[model samples]
Target: MARTHTPRSHLSVLHTSASRFASSPAFYVPQTLSESGDVASWKPISYIQFLHDVELFARHWAHVLKLDGIPRRSVIGMWLSGMTYVDVLHIYGLSRAGYIPQLFSIRLPNPDVVYELLSRANACALLVDPSFEGLLKSCPIPTHRAATTVYDIDSHDMPLPSLPTLRERDTVFIFHTSGSTSGIPKLVPCSSSWLDSAITKSHQIAMPSGRTKRNQDVTVWMGSMCHIAQTFMLLGSLQHGACTVQPSRQAFSSNELSLMIRDCGVNRLNQFATFLAQHLRNSRQNPRLLALLQTLDDALYSGLALPREEEEWAHGNGIRLRNLFGSTECGAMLLSTRGPEMFLQPLDGMSYAFVPVASQSEAGTSQGGHSAPLLELVILAESPDCPDNSLRAADGHFHTGDLFQEIRTGCYLSKGRDDDWIKSENSLRCDTKAIEDNIRATCCDLVAECVVVGNGRPSPALFIETNSDLPQPKLKREVLRRTRQFHSRRYLHERIASADMIVIVEKGSLPRTATKGNVRRRVTEEAFRTVLDKIYGTEWTGTT
Candidate 1:
């Protein structure tokens, strides 16, 4: 079949696809999860049915929310805590009704932050999943306690309204940052042009080199539906006539995910690094799960760096792990190709540049312990799909605040956040993310979490939360050995001098950001102030 010309806007593309593939399956919904976490059966939702549901919800919201005569592009807040296919449908439904759906993250547990974001977006109204209505008793906006489940029941026939005319620069969706590094999450508006580019670029890069076909028969999305990446992928997949499977429960177990992968015949998988690590660990004990994972055509991860040992293990076991790099501000930018180091392959239709970062240490050493200058990624404003101007700096480019190191010409490795660079008292700069990733990867089996501190102190200290049941003495010995192993190839100032510098805490004790559950390094450092004082109080002299 020859490809159809791409539509001018995101909703137009969906409208076209629904008309063309009316009977084709757009989603495979798990009917039920048995006690053992097995999927009993799958229910396919066709393109026409999905479009019909969207239309129904659009009309219903228009009536109940009194959206009649509302101005186009009015902001509407949506928080569907336990995400489902219905929530995704409502996003389109809201957009079709000439409103922008501003999504709130389920991972962000604090209602105050959500309220702040809602006020910041100037949302006209807020709609929440019925299950989470209790959370926002004091919400300032006009809160509507509703559920898409009402539309699930039988509905009277209604005439479909004409597609609203939307420009390329029109805001279609709104997402926010996790605020893992920054304090409060900021609203990121996605333009129609941005969504269109994402859909087109995703289809272009869907196929690998050796793959004979470009069809994504069944793709399982394992991340939060509120995540921008998942949202982009969902739109892209539907436009390409692919079937997607998502989790039914708020929190799905590994067994449930594995069952979905096996039963749904999933070829492509998109998951976070933490969940991937858990699956990898579980696969070690279950060969059947390992075999299922190896059968996947494409395995992708983002949000955080995958541990080195796990990446090696996946590739060794024939799982083609691909790293996806993108942000809420910018749609998908790069997809890593097969290589020794995960060198990024830039996607088409996006304009991005790298600005050189200053040398870190007195020796003029850059990040990654190499002479190559570390580069900060800048998303050029000239890109065809450039979204809103909120993040654009005075230079007319959105500085992503992400740092990368070039390993080869035109290929780079993501080093960590440029703002996360820590300077020790000896004037040597330490890459905190690098050290944390290394320690976590090296001692993955024993450590639940790791954070490096001591910004202006003698040396960086290692704080780890133990995940193992081994005795403290034995665990400390093993941890020290691994720490030494990690320090073997490092420069002098980057190493944690003695075993005394290693502080072990109880599991689940580290402070995490309310948004994405990422460890709040500054907050954690403050929480362990006494321990840090004790460690740094003594004459912790090291050769500098």
Candidate 2:
């Protein structure tokens, strides 16, 4: 029998993208933003050219590498810029040769973190970008620790080599989750089929038809190549026949972004909610800038939810705002545009076989501050490829620590993470989501984001990221007042440590998911350890 199209396989993506959209451009960086991170006229790279490059890379993998015919699939650790053509080809070519290509973040300049990742991955060979030279220098271990080695493909003296055949199930991408849990990385093994499924679904759901190079969802891939967002942007652009707006090495500023969108005829954005909010606030000062955003059809974000007013702002401006919900573990429980029911429905011949929801207790207080219990997500089979899918429980389902509620039968809404639950200083259980949600509802006008801290402390304290540029006293008062109100009424049993426990911080101060843009509670709590201690210590009870 002939090979039938399987679940989101990239084995065919290469052929289809190159053949079906042969004339279309695969990668585009405007002349204003060039390789040097300066204004320089450069031609776009077409799908054909991209494929030829992939061929070269594949050949390099087959013959040039010392570990060409290794027993196991070699893991090639990649350190490259976001959404670069080389990054795509490196991954595509490596996948073809049965090598797992894992990307490291360019923004993480810290040598220790980079080394820790490399050591953990045990990348047999590294394909590093020239810019990451400092990373090479900082390798405390013997550069070739154990059997590990390096291959600077850019400067390698080797010529073109033959390419090897790839098995559809040959690739399993290794992803390191954001240090959301105690600053330790969670290594996730997501197979190519799983990735292909995500990319295809994302392309099918997110990419609108009739998109041209000038009026396409020309996303400036802000997330690092390591992120799932990068996978969507890179491959989704290819499938959609759209152009990826590659800004300079640095992310586009509000002014620069506005100019780029206007001049480039851009149509989409994937950014942090806080970042977009700040830009919107900036736009108020320059009405012309705000007017420019009206051209976009959609803006996708992760991290903080956009305040209702901002959501209204997007709606009034004829833009669709989406807060994508999911984790590296669950492959996106919900997308912004689609209903939760649609997600659970089989997409492209792949289904995890969903199970019924059940009530699960955690260390934290219940749904209504120790009243109702949170419903646990018991996913039966998230993916066949992820053999290590621990989300699956002994009950033959992936019992997620995430709480959800079926609003009306099929439709569902995510409450928060049950795993983030912790005991408060006052002997009450608390979770970051409940605190953040309460703050957003009660004090939306006051803070950009209200992160609940003080895990294992006397009481939960608020790390307030104020929305305004104005003086702090009034905003502080507003937050304190709101906290008092929530404590008195909605969450009577779970009291928020007093006003003085609230610490006002600037925007972008807290850490967030690179892809989803969701705030990481554990990371944020750790970051404000001093403030947490203050809130839990002797001064906490006496705090003004």
Q: Local distance difference test, per candidate?
A: 0.70, 0.56
TM-score of each: 0.73, 0.64
How much does candidate 2 score in TM-score?
A: 0.64
In candidate 1, stretches whose alpha carbon ends up further than 4 angstroms from where it belongs are 1-7, 36-38, 67-71, 148-158, 180-183, 207-216, 249-251, 362-370, 421-544
Compose the digit string of candidate 1's lDDT tens values, residues 104-180: 75555556667878888888888887667778878887877656563453333444445776666777788876432
Clashes (backbone N, CA, C under 3 Å), per candidate, total 0, 13
Best candidate (score: TM-score): 1
Single out the weakest 10-residue window by summed lDDT for candidate 2: 141-150
